[model samples]
Target: MLTQTRNVEEKLYFNRFVVDAGRPHITVRPHERPSAELRSLTHMCPAGCYSQNEAGQVEIATDGCLECGTCRIVTARTGEVEWNYPRGGFGILYKFG
Candidate 1:
Protein backbone atom coordinates (compact mmCIF):
# COMPACT_ATOMS: atom_id res chain seq x y z
CA MET A 1 0.00 0.00 0.00
CA LEU A 2 1.15 3.54 -0.84
CA THR A 3 -0.14 6.95 0.26
CA GLN A 4 -0.49 9.79 -2.18
CA THR A 5 1.62 12.87 -1.50
CA ARG A 6 0.01 16.32 -1.62
CA ASN A 7 0.89 19.93 -1.01
CA VAL A 8 -0.51 21.10 2.33
CA GLU A 9 0.26 24.79 1.83
CA GLU A 10 -2.01 26.38 -0.70
CA LYS A 11 -4.70 29.03 -1.12
CA LEU A 12 -8.01 27.32 -1.74
CA TYR A 13 -11.10 28.91 -3.22
CA PHE A 14 -14.30 28.41 -1.32
CA ASN A 15 -17.26 29.21 -3.54
CA ARG A 16 -20.94 28.68 -3.00
CA PHE A 17 -21.56 31.44 -0.49
CA VAL A 18 -24.46 30.43 1.65
CA VAL A 19 -27.07 33.17 1.41
CA ASP A 20 -28.85 33.23 4.70
CA ALA A 21 -32.55 33.90 4.74
CA GLY A 22 -31.57 35.94 7.81
CA ARG A 23 -34.24 37.22 10.14
CA PRO A 24 -37.90 37.24 9.18
CA HIS A 25 -37.65 40.90 8.27
CA ILE A 26 -34.61 40.13 6.08
CA THR A 27 -36.40 37.56 4.03
CA VAL A 28 -38.75 38.63 1.27
CA ARG A 29 -42.11 39.59 2.61
CA PRO A 30 -44.82 37.03 2.04
CA HIS A 31 -46.79 39.46 -0.09
CA GLU A 32 -43.79 40.57 -2.10
CA ARG A 33 -43.83 39.97 -5.83
CA PRO A 34 -40.76 38.76 -7.63
CA SER A 35 -40.35 41.06 -10.60
CA ALA A 36 -37.76 41.08 -13.34
CA GLU A 37 -38.41 44.76 -13.91
CA LEU A 38 -37.36 45.46 -10.34
CA ARG A 39 -34.07 43.61 -10.76
CA SER A 40 -33.24 45.77 -13.75
CA LEU A 41 -34.58 49.03 -12.37
CA THR A 42 -32.59 49.27 -9.14
CA HIS A 43 -29.01 49.04 -7.95
CA MET A 44 -29.85 46.71 -5.06
CA CYS A 45 -33.48 46.02 -5.83
CA PRO A 46 -36.15 45.48 -3.16
CA ALA A 47 -34.38 42.21 -2.41
CA GLY A 48 -32.29 44.15 0.11
CA CYS A 49 -28.93 42.40 -0.09
CA TYR A 50 -27.10 45.56 0.90
CA SER A 51 -29.27 47.49 3.29
CA GLN A 52 -30.19 51.15 3.06
CA ASN A 53 -28.27 53.87 4.88
CA GLU A 54 -29.69 56.14 7.60
CA ALA A 55 -30.81 58.58 4.89
CA GLY A 56 -32.60 55.80 2.98
CA GLN A 57 -29.65 55.35 0.59
CA VAL A 58 -28.33 51.95 -0.26
CA GLU A 59 -24.92 51.02 1.13
CA ILE A 60 -22.56 49.38 -1.35
CA ALA A 61 -21.54 45.78 -0.89
CA THR A 62 -18.68 45.96 -3.35
CA ASP A 63 -16.74 43.17 -1.69
CA GLY A 64 -19.41 40.59 -2.45
CA CYS A 65 -21.42 42.47 -5.06
CA LEU A 66 -20.25 40.30 -7.97
CA GLU A 67 -18.88 43.51 -9.48
CA CYS A 68 -21.99 44.23 -11.59
CA GLY A 69 -21.10 47.91 -10.96
CA THR A 70 -24.79 48.63 -10.71
CA CYS A 71 -24.34 50.37 -7.35
CA ARG A 72 -22.82 53.41 -8.96
CA ILE A 73 -24.77 53.42 -12.21
CA VAL A 74 -28.30 52.69 -11.13
CA THR A 75 -30.34 55.90 -11.35
CA ALA A 76 -32.54 54.88 -8.43
CA ARG A 77 -32.52 57.44 -5.63
CA THR A 78 -32.85 54.88 -2.89
CA GLY A 79 -30.34 52.38 -4.22
CA GLU A 80 -27.29 54.54 -4.64
CA VAL A 81 -24.86 52.59 -2.44
CA GLU A 82 -21.40 53.64 -1.35
CA TRP A 83 -18.49 51.22 -1.34
CA ASN A 84 -16.92 49.77 1.80
CA TYR A 85 -13.36 48.52 2.09
CA PRO A 86 -12.69 44.87 2.70
CA ARG A 87 -12.86 44.36 6.45
CA GLY A 88 -9.42 43.44 7.81
CA GLY A 89 -8.56 42.48 4.21
CA PHE A 90 -10.87 39.54 4.52
CA GLY A 91 -13.65 39.61 1.97
CA ILE A 92 -14.92 37.97 -1.19
CA LEU A 93 -12.03 36.88 -3.40
CA TYR A 94 -13.45 35.62 -6.67
CA LYS A 95 -11.44 32.69 -7.97
CA PHE A 96 -13.40 31.32 -10.90
CA GLY A 97 -16.44 31.31 -8.68
Candidate 2:
Protein backbone atom coordinates (compact mmCIF):
# COMPACT_ATOMS: atom_id res chain seq x y z
CA MET A 1 0.00 0.00 0.00
CA LEU A 2 1.02 3.62 -0.45
CA THR A 3 1.49 6.09 2.33
CA GLN A 4 -0.74 9.04 3.12
CA THR A 5 0.07 12.71 2.81
CA ARG A 6 -0.34 16.14 4.32
CA ASN A 7 -2.57 18.68 2.66
CA VAL A 8 -2.75 22.13 4.19
CA GLU A 9 -1.19 21.25 7.51
CA GLU A 10 -1.50 24.87 8.46
CA LYS A 11 -3.80 27.55 7.15
CA LEU A 12 -2.39 30.20 9.38
CA TYR A 13 0.19 29.99 12.13
CA PHE A 14 -3.02 30.17 14.20
CA ASN A 15 -6.82 30.16 13.59
CA ARG A 16 -7.24 27.02 11.48
CA PHE A 17 -10.60 25.74 10.27
CA VAL A 18 -9.07 22.86 8.31
CA VAL A 19 -6.16 20.62 9.08
CA ASP A 20 -4.60 17.16 8.54
CA ALA A 21 -5.49 16.46 4.94
CA GLY A 22 -4.58 12.78 5.42
CA ARG A 23 -3.66 11.81 1.83
CA PRO A 24 -1.18 12.61 -0.86
CA HIS A 25 -2.18 13.99 -4.25
CA ILE A 26 -5.47 15.13 -2.78
CA THR A 27 -5.10 18.59 -4.33
CA VAL A 28 -4.85 20.83 -1.30
CA ARG A 29 -2.97 24.02 -0.65
CA PRO A 30 -3.06 27.15 1.46
CA HIS A 31 -4.95 29.69 -0.58
CA GLU A 32 -4.98 33.40 0.14
CA ARG A 33 -7.89 34.17 -2.10
CA PRO A 34 -9.03 37.55 -3.34
CA SER A 35 -12.14 39.15 -1.84
CA ALA A 36 -15.40 39.24 -3.76
CA GLU A 37 -16.73 42.33 -5.51
CA LEU A 38 -20.42 42.00 -4.68
CA ARG A 39 -21.41 45.30 -3.11
CA SER A 40 -24.36 43.83 -1.19
CA LEU A 41 -22.03 42.41 1.42
CA THR A 42 -21.89 44.44 4.61
CA HIS A 43 -22.15 42.92 8.12
CA MET A 44 -19.49 40.72 9.68
CA CYS A 45 -20.46 37.39 11.22
CA PRO A 46 -21.77 38.31 14.63
CA ALA A 47 -22.28 34.61 15.32
CA GLY A 48 -18.53 33.97 15.57
CA CYS A 49 -17.47 31.60 12.82
CA TYR A 50 -13.87 32.52 13.39
CA SER A 51 -13.82 31.30 16.96
CA GLN A 52 -14.62 27.84 15.68
CA ASN A 53 -11.22 27.55 14.03
CA GLU A 54 -8.07 26.45 15.80
CA ALA A 55 -7.19 30.03 16.54
CA GLY A 56 -9.75 32.59 17.65
CA GLN A 57 -10.08 34.44 14.38
CA VAL A 58 -13.39 34.38 12.50
CA GLU A 59 -13.91 36.98 9.81
CA ILE A 60 -14.60 34.73 6.90
CA ALA A 61 -16.77 31.99 5.52
CA THR A 62 -20.14 31.73 3.78
CA ASP A 63 -22.59 32.93 6.36
CA GLY A 64 -23.63 36.46 5.57
CA CYS A 65 -20.24 36.84 3.96
CA LEU A 66 -20.67 40.12 2.12
CA GLU A 67 -17.94 39.50 -0.47
CA CYS A 68 -16.79 42.92 0.53
CA GLY A 69 -13.25 43.34 1.91
CA THR A 70 -14.36 42.11 5.32
CA CYS A 71 -12.39 38.88 5.59
CA ARG A 72 -9.66 38.80 2.96
CA ILE A 73 -8.01 42.21 2.87
CA VAL A 74 -8.79 43.70 6.26
CA THR A 75 -9.28 40.72 8.56
CA ALA A 76 -6.32 38.89 7.09
CA ARG A 77 -4.14 41.91 7.74
CA THR A 78 -5.24 42.15 11.36
CA GLY A 79 -4.58 38.40 11.73
CA GLU A 80 -8.13 37.58 12.85
CA VAL A 81 -8.77 34.75 10.40
CA GLU A 82 -12.24 33.26 10.20
CA TRP A 83 -12.91 32.11 6.66
CA ASN A 84 -13.00 29.44 3.98
CA TYR A 85 -14.36 29.32 0.47
CA PRO A 86 -16.12 26.58 -1.45
CA ARG A 87 -14.22 24.76 -4.14
CA GLY A 88 -14.67 26.19 -7.58
CA GLY A 89 -17.70 24.68 -9.37
CA PHE A 90 -18.98 23.42 -6.05
CA GLY A 91 -20.76 24.64 -2.93
CA ILE A 92 -23.52 27.17 -3.48
CA LEU A 93 -24.03 27.47 -7.19
CA TYR A 94 -25.33 30.98 -7.07
CA LYS A 95 -27.02 31.81 -10.30
CA PHE A 96 -28.13 34.85 -8.37
CA GLY A 97 -26.89 33.94 -4.92
Candidate 3:
Protein backbone atom coordinates (compact mmCIF):
# COMPACT_ATOMS: atom_id res chain seq x y z
CA MET A 1 0.00 0.00 0.00
CA LEU A 2 1.15 3.50 -0.80
CA THR A 3 0.27 6.63 1.13
CA GLN A 4 0.23 10.20 -0.06
CA THR A 5 -0.63 13.46 1.63
CA ARG A 6 -1.68 16.74 0.12
CA ASN A 7 -2.36 20.14 1.65
CA VAL A 8 -5.80 21.73 1.48
CA GLU A 9 -4.90 23.95 -1.47
CA GLU A 10 -3.41 21.11 -3.40
CA LYS A 11 -6.37 18.88 -2.72
CA LEU A 12 -8.78 21.59 -3.71
CA TYR A 13 -7.19 21.81 -7.11
CA PHE A 14 -8.67 18.44 -7.94
CA ASN A 15 -12.19 19.73 -7.25
CA ARG A 16 -14.37 21.73 -9.62
CA PHE A 17 -16.83 24.50 -8.84
CA VAL A 18 -19.80 25.27 -11.04
CA VAL A 19 -20.89 28.73 -10.05
CA ASP A 20 -24.33 30.08 -10.78
CA ALA A 21 -24.06 33.55 -12.26
CA GLY A 22 -26.02 36.20 -10.37
CA ARG A 23 -27.13 33.56 -7.91
CA PRO A 24 -25.11 32.98 -4.80
CA HIS A 25 -26.01 30.20 -2.42
CA ILE A 26 -24.48 32.01 0.53
CA THR A 27 -24.66 35.67 1.38
CA VAL A 28 -24.26 37.97 4.34
CA ARG A 29 -27.62 39.45 5.16
CA PRO A 30 -27.92 43.10 4.22
CA HIS A 31 -29.12 44.18 7.66
CA GLU A 32 -26.33 42.37 9.43
CA ARG A 33 -23.43 44.75 9.62
CA PRO A 34 -19.97 43.93 10.82
CA SER A 35 -19.96 42.36 14.26
CA ALA A 36 -18.21 39.72 16.30
CA GLU A 37 -20.30 37.05 14.61
CA LEU A 38 -19.53 38.36 11.13
CA ARG A 39 -15.88 38.88 11.87
CA SER A 40 -15.61 35.37 13.17
CA LEU A 41 -16.50 34.15 9.67
CA THR A 42 -13.30 35.68 8.39
CA HIS A 43 -11.37 33.16 10.41
CA MET A 44 -13.82 30.29 10.42
CA CYS A 45 -14.54 29.86 6.72
CA PRO A 46 -12.20 27.17 5.44
CA ALA A 47 -12.56 28.36 1.86
CA GLY A 48 -11.44 31.89 2.82
CA CYS A 49 -14.62 33.35 1.37
CA TYR A 50 -15.07 35.89 4.16
CA SER A 51 -12.78 38.84 4.61
CA GLN A 52 -12.51 42.12 6.50
CA ASN A 53 -12.39 45.37 4.59
CA GLU A 54 -10.31 48.41 5.48
CA ALA A 55 -13.33 49.91 7.21
CA GLY A 56 -13.46 46.86 9.47
CA GLN A 57 -16.45 45.45 7.68
CA VAL A 58 -16.86 41.82 6.82
CA GLU A 59 -17.53 40.88 3.21
CA ILE A 60 -18.05 37.64 1.34
CA ALA A 61 -17.24 36.48 -2.16
CA THR A 62 -18.76 33.16 -3.08
CA ASP A 63 -16.67 32.37 -6.12
CA GLY A 64 -14.46 29.78 -4.47
CA CYS A 65 -16.85 28.65 -1.79
CA LEU A 66 -16.47 24.99 -0.83
CA GLU A 67 -20.15 24.65 0.06
CA CYS A 68 -19.09 23.06 3.34
CA GLY A 69 -21.81 24.74 5.41
CA THR A 70 -19.32 26.15 7.88
CA CYS A 71 -20.71 29.68 7.61
CA ARG A 72 -24.25 28.50 8.06
CA ILE A 73 -23.36 26.36 11.03
CA VAL A 74 -21.50 29.15 12.77
CA THR A 75 -24.23 31.78 12.32
CA ALA A 76 -27.24 29.48 12.35
CA ARG A 77 -28.79 31.19 15.37
CA THR A 78 -27.86 34.77 14.49
CA GLY A 79 -29.69 35.08 11.16
CA GLU A 80 -26.71 37.04 9.95
CA VAL A 81 -26.16 34.69 7.05
CA GLU A 82 -28.54 33.46 4.42
CA TRP A 83 -27.47 30.08 3.12
CA ASN A 84 -28.91 27.59 0.65
CA TYR A 85 -27.63 24.94 -1.64
CA PRO A 86 -26.79 26.11 -5.12
CA ARG A 87 -29.19 25.10 -7.84
CA GLY A 88 -28.66 21.63 -9.25
CA GLY A 89 -25.41 21.24 -11.18
CA PHE A 90 -24.13 24.54 -9.82
CA GLY A 91 -21.83 23.82 -6.92
CA ILE A 92 -18.75 21.95 -5.87
CA LEU A 93 -17.94 18.69 -7.68
CA TYR A 94 -15.43 16.72 -5.74
CA LYS A 95 -13.09 14.84 -8.04
CA PHE A 96 -11.40 12.79 -5.35
CA GLY A 97 -13.11 10.38 -3.04
Candidate with the greatest lDDT versus the true structure: 3
Cα-based lDDT for every prediction:
0.35, 0.32, 0.84
Clashing pairs in 1: none
Q: What is the C-alpha RMSD of each candidate to the true structure, in Å?
A: 11.3, 16.2, 1.8
Alpha-carbon runs more than 4 Å astray in model 3: 1-3
User: In candidate 1, where is summed lDDT lowest over 10 consecutive residues?
Assistant: 22-31
Task: Return the TM-score for each candidate structure.
Answer: 0.30, 0.28, 0.85
Runs in model 2 deviating more than 4 A are 1-69, 82-84
Q: Is candidate 1 or candidate 3 better by TM-score?
A: 3
lDDT of 1: 0.35
- Model 2 per-residue lDDT at 32: 45
- lDDT by residue (tens digit), candidate 2, 1-66: 997543432321222122223321111123343233211122343322232224322223343222
> What TM-score does candidate 3 get on C-alpha atoms?
0.85
Which candidate ranks first by TM-score, i.e. highest?
3
Record all residue pairs in model 3 with backbone atoms less than 3 Å apart, i.e. clashing. Answer: none
lDDT of 1 at 91: 41
Q: What is the lDDT of residue 8 in candidate 2?
A: 34
Let me know the TM-score candidate 1 reaches against the reference structure: 0.30
Error of 3 at 68 (Å): 1.1
Each prediction's number of clashing residue pairs: 0, 7, 0
What's model 1's lDDT at 88?
37
